[model samples]
Every structure is written in C-alpha cells, then in structure tokens.
Target: MNRINAHNLACPIDGALLVCHDKQLRCEHGHSFDIARQGYVNLLPVQHKRSRQPGDSKEMVAARARFLNSGLYEPLASRLARITSALVPENRKTSLMDAGCGEGYYSDTVFKYLEDRGASSGLSFIGLDISKPAILEAAKRNRQITWLVGTNRQPPVTPASIDIILCVFGFQSFEGFRHILKPGGRLVLVEPGPDHLKELREVIYSEVKKSRPQDLTPVMETGFSLVDEQSFQYKTGEISKHIIADLLLMTPHFYRTNKAGREAAAHLEVLDLTVDIVFRTLEFQNP
Candidate 1:
C-alpha cells in the first residue's frame, strides 16, 4: 500500500489512525486488521455487521464481474472518468474514495482515465465495500487501489482526508460521507434515472410504478451544496440472453421479482436495454 494512502485509513473499532506494520494495519488501541493474500484488508468489525453476510453475495459479485468485464457499461464508466477528471485540478495531490465500490469497476476505470489524461500530480484511489467477495473481485481489477472490506456507515478512513467520494449506484450515508471528506470536498454521485431499465421492469412486473427523481433535501441539510448535474441515456444495441441474466442479477429488482416475473425474464432471447442515469456533484460547505 502507498504510504499516503495507508495514512488515509482509520481503525474501524475506534476510528483511530492506523499504521501499516508487518503486513497489517494496526491502530494505537491495538486493534488490528490483517492484510489478505488477495492484497485487500477486512476492516469490518462484528459489531458493525448488520448480518452474518452483510453485503452482496458471492454469486451476485461473480455475475456483476462477468457483466462489467464484458464492457457493457463502458460508456457509463468513461463518463464517470471524464466528469471526475474535470473536477480535479492537474497540479495538486487528490484523494478519491469510492463508497461501496463493487468489483472496483468504476474506480479502476477512473484511475486509468486520470492516468491517461496525464493528471499525474498524485492520485490516491481507495475503494471500500461491505462485501468481502466484492472486495476480492475488486482486488483482481487493480492492486494499486486500496480495497477494504468496510461499510459506508463506518468507513475505515481518516476523517476529513478525502478530496472526492464517489458513490456510483451505491448507498450514501450522509453523516459518514460528511465526516470523511475534507472541507470543500466534492461528492460525485450516479443514480438510476426514471427510465433506467424500463423494458426490464416491464418484464419483471405486471404493473410498473412511475420513477421519481431522487430528493437531495437530506443531503443538502448536511451542509453540502449542489455544484452541477447532468442526465443522459445510453441504449444498448442487441443484448444477449446471457447479458440479460447478468443484468437481472446486478440489480435489486431481481430479488423483489416474483417467480413468474423471473421466469419471464429468464426466457428472454434478447433485449435492447435503455440505461438512464443521473450524475450530480455536491461540494461540502465548511462551517
């Protein structure tokens, strides 16, 4: 792990600073998390766990990895990279953390994108997820990124040390996020738009509810102001049955769908999917 990046980590037990010592991250209070052979660390403590298996399952991660690796979401990834790169100036050190980074897809893509753009001023990329399987799969994407098995509620990161926090189609705990980001730091968030996967929803449910835009009042109440916003749609050409299956597994709708709904989706030969996404940037206002 990079020394600077390691400094950004904190103890999950007590939120104390952590030091990398002998292949483990140890805190002043003697709480320690061992580095796994896969080059990631598990920082999730038992008390913080919501369940025995908290986050994404192994099967879900595997399906997501397969789907993402196929480059179906490359456009979204590229857009994220471009937008994020534009936000950071080229001549200064920048620390970016991905909250709930699954399989490290966006993080890896953004890392490479910044490198390609020659913003070499010093980029520290960290990805954290509650799922061990997700972090393990993420580790395979890029060893340079610090992947931690941690939760958004109690992120294993130093307070006010991050420049940007990326929450791409993931959970965002306003309190936790506000605590970790430096003053004036930005949060780049990507969420599903109303029309996102409409066709798939139609197949999965008999009646579809209208999709409403995400309300940011709660986020704004936490002393963050919206800086910019954009919405766009990406339509896939002809998607195969295998890709359709992957899509179903990658989304939350899969678990909520009825037996008949799942059967209908499973029998699909091909589908042309429309992916609508909304991007927003919020900057923290230091008091």
Candidate 2:
C-alpha cells in the first residue's frame, strides 16, 4: 500500500480541506486531484498559473544540477538531512514537501538518507517547483519521489497535512506554508548566510556589498515560531569558466553585476567559492 504524507495539504483552489485517500485527493467541492503514477500529486490549479512555464529555466536548472553534483554543497545537504530526520515521528508515516525544489538535488539527497535508515515506507517526499522543465528533470533523476510543476504561493497539498516543509534557497510563501503545515509541523528553511559566495561576489564586482541575512521576524509574525537555528560554512574548489558563467546567470548576483564585472569573471583563473548556509526550523503558531 502507498502511504502518502497527507497531513500538510489543503485545497489549492478554495483553501478548504483536502482528503487524500486511495491514490486521489478530493476536496469538499468535488474537485479531485490524482496521484501520478510516479507517486507525485499535482495541486496546481489553472487559474493560479500566470505563465505557460515558470520559475527557473532549463539552462538554470542544468547549471544548478551540475554545480550541486560537483559536491559544492554536500555539507549543506547533509545538514538538512540530519535535521529533517530528527523531526520525523517514531511510528507514524511522515511526509516532506520541498517548496521550490529546484532540480531535486536537495530533496533527493534528503529522501535517500531517510530511506536508507528504513524510513522509506513511512515517508513520502514531494518536490514542487514552478518550472515544468525542472520538474521533468527531477522526475527523470529521482523516480521514487514525487515532482510537481507548481508555485510556493499556491502549493497543491491539503491544509495542515505535511509534517515537514522545506524551502531551500528559494522563494517562500509563509502564509501558504502555514496553511499547509499541521499543528506543530516543522518548517526547515535554508538561506544564504551573509558571507555566502563571497569569492564570486568579489570577482563579479569591484566592491561587494555585505547585505544582512534575511529577517525571519516577518515569517514569525505570520504565525511561525522559530524552534532551532544553525549555520554551516564550506569552500568549494575551482570551477570552469563556462560553469562559472552559468552560475552567475542562475543567481541573483547576475543582475547586479555589470558588463565589466562579467568580463572580469569570464577571465578569472579560478574561484574559491565559499558557501554560508543557514538552517532554521520553525513550528506553526496560532495566528
């Protein structure tokens, strides 16, 4: 029998209760969503869609996959796995939803870790991204997990159904997240620390601006209380010029970097990339 983690879901269309049963999730108004053969459920409603395709492009997805597979961010993934594992209940089935799950690198890694510990049967992993190409690539690489082309603003699950919600280096919709997570359900958010990618910033611009890390207070204000927090740092080895260019294009820094900056990065010898990864675990609180 396939046991889906359905506690963190809600009807995407009307914000009503969603019943996940017998491989189908049905809302009170007779709207039904089928669970894909590959084990993922698509909760994106047509009205919420603004574009034919969304989120990261194929180029960005490929570049991210390459960079991640190069082991540049293994430590970050490991840290996330450890934290997520600790949150699972001992006997009950668990479900994890990765919002903006780009290319499935982090989701696949974490799911594998849990599965290796005999937690596979009790856990279901869902990777949701707005980009159809990203969802396609993720589904191709990790067939065991569910991948959906959807947005964080309108996740396709039932309200208060998920046990864990993960947002890694992607946009977050706190209200949407709060609505989907069960009471006491945990939200694991990974964001770039202040010093993240300092090397790349240095090479791309004459002066690097030291921006403050994201303020979680706003999220807290939306009814999430911080339960735990941690930070990890590591250095990634040299990358090819072409890969480096792709990395720049896939990141927010690309827009900030000027033409001269791009030319400078294009001719760099090697980049000593540094990653400052911050992890925060939050629990839903009453609004």
Candidate 3:
C-alpha cells in the first residue's frame, strides 16, 4: 500500500483525485472512504452492485485461498509474472493493476518476483476485487499490496495511470481497462484451456462438453491487439480426495453440480488431473 500514492487513486463517484491520510481516502468533493481494519479499502458503491452480495461468496473465497496456497497453480503464477515483467518497459517506474484479483495470489506472486528482480522501487501494485472477503484475505497476505473491494466495471483508479493490467481467469472490462491504462499499456489475460481440469469434469458430470475456443475478436474490438500468447499444461500427479473436493469448491461448476456429482467428487479416492491454461498479452493502441 505504501507504493500506491494518492495520485494513483480516484473517487468512484465523481472521478476526482483521492488523498489518503490516517487510513482514510478522501476526495476534493468531500467523498470519503475508510480503509478497513484489514487494511483494504471499499470503493464499491452500492449503485454499482447488482445483488446484495455480488461476486464470489465467502465460502468460494476461502476455498480458492486454500487451494492456491497448496501451490497447484504455481506454474501459472510464475508464467504470469514472467510475461508481465517482460511487457513492462525497463528504465522507468510502472504501475500495475490486478483486475478482479482473487485473494491477491497472482498479484502478490508477481510483486514478489518483480521485487526480486530489483524492480520493486519502480513498480506499484494495486489489487481490486468486488468481494470484501477476498480483498481482506488478500491484504493479509501482503500489506504492501493496495487491496480494494471495488468493481472492475469502474475501477477506483485514475485514468491512464496504469502501465500493465492483469485479468486472470476473471472478468474483462474492456472500457474500464482502457480508461485506466496508458496508451500502449498491456493487458495480460489468462483463461482456462479445453483440458483445464478435464479429469475433474469427467468425474463430476455425466457429459463433459469440450471447451470452446476463445475468439480474440472481442478483445481486438476494444482497441487492443494481441502481442503474445502461450498455452501451458502440467500434471497434478495423483491428487487426494481433499484436493478433489477443494478443486470442486474452487470452480464455478460447484454451483451447478447435482447431488450425485457432488457426492462423486466428495467420495473420490485419488485422481490425476491436468492443469491447462492459456496466457494472452494484448497491447492497447489508441485509434
């Protein structure tokens, strides 16, 4: 949080600059947001919320945190950091935003990697998620990360203040991303591939549909051109029943699964699964 200055933040309502002092963020228009006891700030205005509780629930957040802590996705995290670090230009300070950052796992990993490479002084890390529990959990992992319970549709960040935006297995707000990124800034996107957890799907569902191919056309329409993309696959060796249950809980399928599917996953003894993912780099180009 120390690396994020007041200049980097904006009032969610009026888009005015915010000044942080005494754990409170205030704008010139008299809008004030208090930093939580957990060190995260809530910038999600009620008007922007579609439900009483938007985004991942507390249970989902906990499941993801627990699963990620097991380091099953460390390869994806490392690749993300490597790709992001390469996209950020050298010899200058850079601001990075992790849009829909879940539990700060990816952001924290990337920040640590950058710092180890002697880029800490020149990098600013901001992690935003609509879920308060997720942001609170994220803040606990690294106090230096600027954690915010904010909507990605309208992030609480100044226009053109960010150099790199990361949208990993989360929502992609093209306009919001473009508004906050400087011209030529990059967006590193990660999405699940067809075989991503194929074994789990097979075990849980009677008919496991093949994953569809991603169309970059939508991204291109948002004033971004694809720069680079890489697909990654790794084996989980032999996973335990506990991990199987955790994996089910961590995915969206958990909500849609039937009682039988749930029981099958819960009763699994051992399963070998493949972790398949794709990373895409898109550079913003103003028309």
Question: How many residue pairs clash (N, CA or C atoms closer than 3 angstroms) in each of the candidate models, in the order given?
Answer: 0, 12, 1
TM-score of each: 0.96, 0.88, 0.96
RMSD of 3: 1.5
lDDT of 2 by residue, 162-274 (tens): 88999998888887788678888899999888898888888888888765557887778878999999988888777677768777877877778889888888897678788
Q: Rank order by lDDT, top first? A: 1, 3, 2
Candidate 3: segments with Cα more than 4 A from true spot: 1-6
Q: Which of the two candidates, 1 or 3, achieves a greater lDDT against the reference?
A: 1
Worst 10 residues of 3 by lDDT: 1-10
| Residues 1-287, model 3: lDDT tens digits | 44333258899999998898787999999999998777788899998898988888888899899889889889889999999888766779889999999888999999998888888777778999998888878988887788888988999998988999999888888889989989999998899988989998998899998774478898798789998989899998897888788779878889878989999898899998899998888899776
lDDT of 3: 0.86
User: Which candidate has the top score in lDDT?
Assistant: 1
**Candidate 2 vs candidate 3, TM-score winner:** 3
All-Cα superposition RMSD per candidate: 1.5, 2.9, 1.5
Candidate 1 per-residue lDDT over residues 102-185, each given as its tens digit = 989999999888888887448888899999999989988887788899999888888899999999989888788988899999
